[model samples]
Target chain A: MNILRFITAGSVDDGKSTLIGRLLYDSKSILADQLEQLEKSSAKKNDNGEIDLALLTDGLRAEREQGITIDVAYRYFSTPARKFIIADAPGHVQYTRNMITGASNAELIIILIDARQGVVEQTRRHSIIASLLKIPHVVVAINKMDLVDFSQDVFNNIIIDYSKVATQLGLNDVKFFPISALQGDNIVDRSEHMAWYDGPSLLQFLEEVPVENDTNLKDQRFQVQYVIRPQTDDLHDYRGYAGKVQSGIFKKGDRITVLPAGISTTVTAIEIGGKEVKEAFAPQSVVFQLKDDVDISRGDAFVNAAEAPELKSELDVILCWLDDKPLQTGNKYYLQHNARTIRTIVRTLEHKIDVNTLQPLEITSPVTLNEIVKAKLKTAAPVVYDSYDLLPANGSAILVDETSNSTVAAVLFR
Target chain B: MSAYQLNYLEELEAESIFIMREVAAQFEKPALLFSGGKDSITLVHLARKAFAPAKIPFPLVHIDTGHNFPEALEFRDQMAKEVGATLIVRSVEDTIRVRKLTEPKGKFASRNWLQTYTLLDTIEEFSFDACIGGARRDEEKARAKERIFSVRDEFGQWNPKLQRPELWNIFNGRIHKGENVRVFPISNWTELDVWNYIREEKVGLPSIYFSHERELIEHDGQLIAASDFIRLDPEDVVIKEKVRYRTVGDMTCTAAVRSGANSIDEVINEIKATRISERGETRIDDKVTEAAMEDRKKNGYF
Candidate 1:
């Protein structure tokens, strides 16, 4: 079975946890002992005389006590068709950076909407973030339908409203499902209550959604994570550049360019698990030997010399502020991309995007926690990267504060 | 877009290797926390695959509780030598003598809590900046919320609130001195996935993982192996049963399952059909409190 990494984002009252709980429950992924513990916790936490499904994702003590997810809690489940990794992000407005963290790796995003409220500011913000992250698929689950009497008019109206936001955000691939997460409808099974919605359940759609295309299989992008050279006498001449194929495939004879230094070399040999492999595709960890002994180190990328990504000192980036410390222009931070961390200086703050209207707003102050801003960055050294939209795996990076050593911001190369 | 894609297992392997490579490249001094369990063995396998032809760039450190199965200890020593990795063994027995640590007193008393002190000491002793663990998010509740590159203070306390936002494949391993990061390469792999990987990779495992005849005592409906580490009470009845360990924690804490599954294939089959979670079925430590793992992690327990 293939893997599907996804994110679920909605406000606390939007039944996000209930929806995840329903999927795991229906899929028989929850074990008997876990169910027993849940039953005990539900009795103590829930006064509604029913199991508290939200308790499943709220794994931390502080989160369980406050009834708020403090961080992104990853949940795993599987069926015969697909294995899923759910990045359950908190919905508190201040936790937008956490959602961005989850959305960065997600192939698909499930944006929940209150059936009564339709599309709200939170939905718009989530959609905007998904678009910014370039998540391949967008699924809108208009939940709490049981309260709405499974009204077709309400569902259709919400779809119409969301589609406008989707169109504005350039999110063309969007799917809508009407259900009640509390009542276990339209999550894993068909919602008999909403027969007007004749579509596969959310789980069905997730399993079938083509995530393979999300991986860039055409442009060959690879980074050297480590240069392996055995000091043993028998294999004295072995110098292997070990890394994963960030995108596309690398054959033995492919002429690739070692980035930053821009040295040209041919992949003399490819070995996976110490065995010779003719070609290694994207996401496969393999070791490569070059014809020439180039001065390649960790963080240096290798790409097909013909269609190589740009190597520049200045970069345009959309920064998702994550740290409590505010960011100002000329402030220096380390930009960590794939395997490379380069000394970078913030050149200028262009503007911040108003999440509510998706409009460019001038940055009147230093960017603080959870604020999204567009900025220009200049690296001390030449950096090799593709635009985030063209190649996300090799393009996206994280900004680290040199003082606190905290990941300050999520940098999306533009 | 093309149709060439990797299966879930292959993908998990690739992700793990990526993280392992990051540890090798990012940290000045890194070491693998080898527990001699299936998870750590799988980690060793991945580490070997991560830097093939060349030896793993880091050492394998094991914090022995002195209450482990003989089979597991044997396997740990043998495998470390076989892979040409430097094995650093720090015992809680030594930590107790030097640090004057008071051992817990009970029928199920263990060095599980005190082992943390030894681990922290070892970290300082070697000045290891990163400790690559085999902890999986699917194994426990608190681990689910932990980042792949989790930071800890000098005291080895994990601050959940202060976690960095881990975005995409980019990991920020930058940490201050006297603090170390716990890098979990298999943070995404579940128990089933590990078994599937082991099967596919044909990685060797300890003998205790398979079925064997052993003396076990039933307590609170859980089967605990009768080992010399524990003080047997009059009420506790020891019986001989064909049992196998699901997890290889301290002998004072880990329980066994009644199974005749003598091979990896049979073990996998048993695990597939089981309804109980891995910890719930075998571990006696986590059932102590609702946030047992969280509390342990806060104090630098792996």
Candidate 2:
């Protein structure tokens, strides 16, 4: 089976946790013991006197105390066709850091909308995030359909309003469904309440979505993470570059380039899991034996010599400032990309994004917690990367504070 | 979908392999914290694949609690030698003797807590910047909230609230001089996923995982083995039953289930049919409190 990693764009009030709980509960993923525990710990029960479904996603004591999710908690459930990893994050405006952190690797985003309040600020903000992260799939689940008498007009109006936000942000594959998470309507099975709807249920759409083809197969990029040299007599002279196929395929005899050094080498052999394979594609961890000995260390990129990405010292980036301390211009940070770390200085704070309007406002002050800004960074040396818009797998990095060593920002190269 | 796409297990393997290689590339001195359990065995397997033909780049560090099942130790020794990887064993008994630490006393008192002291000391002695373990998110609730690259303070304490925001799969593993990062490559995998991967890969496990005739004591509906480390009670119901371990920790704290699953397929089926969570069904140490794992994690227990 395949895997679909998605983020639900709502909080407890929006019934995000209830939707997740309904999915897991309806699919029989929640075990008997877990259900018993839920029954024991539920603080809020519905009129039916059943366990609160929202308790399923709350993990920490602090979160339970505050009755809110503070961090991204990954929940796993699977049907026979697919495995789903739900990055359940808080939807309030203050918790944008958590939402973005959860949204970074997600292939899909479920932007929840209450039917009564058609398009709230959160809907636009989440759509902006989906566009910024380039999440492949966008879902608009118009919840509380039962409270609205399962009206088609309410569902269609929300869809019409969400489409404008989706178009403004350039979010693709916008699929909408009318669901009542509290009553389990149109989540796993088609709802009898809404007879006018004819689309597949949320579970059906998830299982049938083409998530397997998300990898970028055109751009060939590899980074030498570890150089394996056995010192024993038999394997004395063997040197291999161990790394994942970040993008594209590497055959046994393909020509490759060693970046930052501009050295060229031939692939002598390819090995995966100790067995010599003819070729390895994207997402496969393999050891590449080069034809000649190269002075390559960790963080050195391996790409096709035919299509080399320009190595530049300056980068135009959008920073999601996640720390309490403000991002001071002219301060240095360690730009970490994969296993490689490079010194970088904040050159300029271009602008701050107003997520509500999907517009940019001129920055007058240093960026602080949960704020997104357009900025320029100058690296000590040239680094190799693609634009975040082109291929995300090979084009992302993080900013690590020099003194505190905390990850202060996520820098997406534009 | 293209043929290049990998299945769920293969995808998980690729992610773990990438993380293993990342640790090898980033840290000056790294070690694989091996406990000879199925999770660690799966980790060792992934590490081997991450750097094939070449031996695992780092040493396999084992913090022995002096309360281990002999079968696990034997299997550990054999597997380390088979893969030509170096094994470093440090015992909790030695740490207690040298550091003058007190051992808590009870009927089934565990050295599981004391093992952390030895682990921290070993890490300091070696100046290891990273320690990779096979901790999964599905095992416990506290673990679910932890980052894949968990940074521990100078004293090896974990701060759940102070964790760095891990964005995408690009982990931020940078730490200061005294701090070290605990990397869990298989953080996304579940208990059933591990069993399925083991079955597909045909990875060898310790003999205790399979059903065998052993002397056991039934306490509070849990079947525990009668080990030398455990101070059994006079009223303890000791019986000889065919039991197999679901998880492997110290012999005193790790419980077994009465089963006839002598094969891997049967074991997988039994796991699929069992309703209780993995840790809840086997680990006695977690039953002391609802936040037992959380408290231990705060104090540097893996």
Candidate 3:
């Protein structure tokens, strides 16, 4: 069985929570005791608590009181064929940073919409953000179909509007499904009311989505986490480079180049748990032994020299300001890319994105909280990397303020 | 190693190694919270894998309640020596004498909660910036919300709302001087995944993890192993049974289950078929309420 991780984002009342609740309830993922508790809580009358499917979610008590999701709540459920991880994020405009944090590693983004309202500002905002974050798949779940009498026209209209926005961005794998989460239609099972629709159910689509090839496999990059040296009598001369295979495949006798030093060596062995393995691939943790000593240490990248990534001293990044403080221009911040940290300056703020319109606001000033902007960065030293479109692990970085040691922003190099 | 395909276990192993390195690189003084349990034993093995061909750089710190299983104590010393890592023992008995923690005058009363005070004292004594634990989210509800790099305040209190947002592969381990981070490398792993990984990695755990014939007493719908620390009641009759511990903790609080899972494979298969959670069978503290684990977490019980 495969594992799929997705993030759901929309406005507060756009039926985002209802959709997830419906999926969990319909799939028999909810425990019997938990459902009984939910039923009891829903019956207790107070501000939409009665029969409020949203109550099934919104775990935090404070979130329930405020009637909003304040943080990213992760939920897991598995069907026979695949397992699913839902990074349920807050939908408020103030929590856009939270959405980015939740959707960073997500392979799919579920953008919910109300059929009665067609397409709204928040819908376009989240879709654009998902595209910018390079989410591989986007499912536009047109929710609240029951509110619009389960009208196929209402669903079709929203799809047309969303298509225009999705085209402006580079998201071609966008899918649409009309779902009545309150009535459990077109979510886990097909809706009889929407006979005009001929697509798979939302759960079926999620299960069948192709996500294995999402990671870049051409560029074989291994960032040395730690250099293991044992002074034991049996293995005194042993030296192993410990790290995860970020991309591509590594095997014995593969010629690899160690970054920051650029010395080439052949792979002698790959060890997982004190034993040698024949091969390792992306997302696998295995220690590598080089045929020759190349002075590799922690924070060094090992790559195939023939297909090596570009080493750069500066990068133009699309950054989301995460901290509460405004990102000051011309400020020096430490950029953590992989294991290495280098001091970098905010060279130029190209444009601050207007969340509502998805338009670039050409600004030279500082970016405030919950704002996304493109900026040029100049690093103190050259670091090995790749384009975001090519390899996400090597392409992305984060800015940390050296003075306070706070993560100020998450940067995706363009 | 390459003959069989264990993709899920391998992914878990990869992520755990990444987290282990992050703790080593991010914290000033990091230590492993070893409790001589299967989970901690698996963690020690992963730590060895994370730095293969070298000894684990971090020291192992165990907050002994002095009510531990005798087999667990012997296993702890042997594993620490095998890994060649420094082991520091802090006892709740010390705190019970120095702070005069009240002892309950009952047969089943345990010193489980007193270990928290002793653990906090150990952190203060060592000034450890990060404490690596083998806690998995699938253990209980409260653990599900834990961040990979969890921060505790100066008083060692966990405020879930104030947790820092952890982005993709970027963990922020910065905290105040008095504050420390509780790092769980296996936070996403489940109990089945742990046993499967252990089986595949050939990690050696204590012999107590295997099924053995032991004297047991029935209490609170659980099968409690009779130990030296446990006093028998007049009505509570002792019977010999074949049992194994699902989890190893304080001898008084950790219960045993009727099982014949002597090998890791049998243990994994048993866990797969078991309807009750690991904590439900072993941890007495978790049987109180759904929020019991959360409350303990708030009070700095790791």
Candidate 4:
């Protein structure tokens, strides 16, 4: 089954958690005892004897008491056709890091908007981040249409406002749906309230959407995870290289290059779970036995000799600052990329991006938390990597503060 | 290898292999947590594939609660021999006998929670930097929030609020010397996914997973397997039923469901029609509250 990962972003009271709760509840994903406990918990919070479905997804105790989402709460549910992983992120401005983390790998991002409030800064910020993260799809769910008397004009107006924001962020494929998450309209089933809107329901869109080709298959990237030397009488001197194919495909007899060493070899066999296979493709964890007895270890990558990426010591990157402490110039930290890591220093701050306006500001100092900026980093050693836009699996990196050992920023090569 | 796109199970296998390799490369010393269950067995299989021809690059750690099924113990030994990986077991029974821990009372009581102490002691003794387990996020609520590389403090406790921001495909495993990481490559897998992957990969499992005649007693609306450890109350009634375990845990807490799924295909079909979740039918501790798993996780229970 195809897996569709999505991130949900909206204001605190925009009914994001309630919508997720309803999805889980209506789909029969919640177990018997879980629903029973939810009923009991709802009864205590019921001012007018109505079950607040939000309780099912809003897990944090403080978030439940405050009736707001505080962090990214990941929820998984599946229909027969497809599986869904929802990253329900917080809406507070301070939790922008959480939203970035949630939407980083999302194939689709559902940006919730209050029907009454046509478009707000939070909505634009989410759209900006969705674009910055290169999330392929965007669904603008104009929620609370019932509160606006199910007026067609209200929904149309919100769509127009969202389009303008989407345009500013260079989002090409943005979808709009008017939904009343509380009333279960235009969610799982078609809504009788809006007969004029002829788009497929949210569930239908999710089921039929093309999510299979989201990964990059053009670049053949394989990071050597471990070196296997089977010391047995039958297979004595058997040395195999094992790891997952990050992208593209590899077949027996294909010419492959070992990175850092620039040694050439031919694939002899592919073994997945002890069985020999003819070939391997992206996302398959299969061990490859090469023809040549090359010296290889962990933290090395194998690639097509013709299309090997650059091995460089310096990188220009767009970084999303996630730590409380600012990224000071000339500070050394660990830069982890794929299976490799090395000490990296902030060479210079190029420009700080205003997420809302997409404007770059020149800063002589370091960038702080919740800010996106472009900076130059110099590593102690050369690292093999691709542009994040080309191969997301190999392109991305994280900056860890050496002193605190905390991940302070996510980096994308520019 | 085939013309068709890689299926979901294949994808999960690839991802898990990637994580296993990361653990070996990033950590100084790492161990695999083996529970003799389908999930852990799946992890062991993936680890083998991740470093084929090279003995798995790490040892297996089993925190024995002393309430295990005999079949599980036998299977664990056989699997270790077959894979050629060293198996290390730390018993809670020894911990209790030596006064390192106290045993709970009554038939309903369990040493499951106390196993955390034994596991911590084993980690401290071995100085393992990373311990990979077969925990799935879709299995419970608290697990849903766990990162692929979850860092535990020197005390072995998980702090959800202070968790590292795991972004993109990048996993940050850097931690202090005392702080260790709990890695779950299959954290995103569901129960159905596990079964499907097992079938697709043609992975071998213990015979207890298949339907067979077993003596069970009804207790707290659960079909607990009748064993020497279980004390029969006057109100309890035993019956012989053809049953299979959906999940393999301690014999006392893991329940058996009436099934005729003698094969993997039959098990898959049965699971599709079943209305209850896997934990709902198999786990006893999860029945107590909605936050049961979350609370246990916060207390350093894996």
Most TM-score-accurate candidate: 1
lDDT of 4: 0.85
Best by DockQ: 1
True contacts kept of each: 0.93, 0.77, 0.30, 0.62
Clash tally for model 3: 0
Worst 10 residues of 2 chain B by lDDT: B286-295
Order of models, best DockQ first: 1, 2, 4, 3
Write candidate 1's Cα lDDT for B79-135 as tens digits. Answer: 999999999999999999998888899999988999999999999999999999999
- For the predicted complex of model 4, DockQ is 0.55
Q: Interface-residue RMSD per candidate?
A: 1.4, 1.3, 3.6, 2.6
In order of appearance, the predictions have TM-scores of 0.99, 0.97, 0.90, 0.95
- Quote the chain B TM-score of every prediction: 0.98, 0.98, 0.96, 0.97
Which residue runs of candidate 4 sit more than 4 Å off their true CA positions?
Answer: A362-366, B1-4
Candidate 4 chain B, poorest ten consecutive residues by summed lDDT: B1-10
Q: Candidates 2 and 3: which is better by DockQ? A: 2
Question: By descending lDDT, how would the candidates be arranged?
Answer: 1, 2, 4, 3
- Which lDDT value does model 2 have at A289? 90
Q: Please, what is the whole-model Cα lDDT of each candidate in the order they appear?
A: 0.91, 0.88, 0.82, 0.85
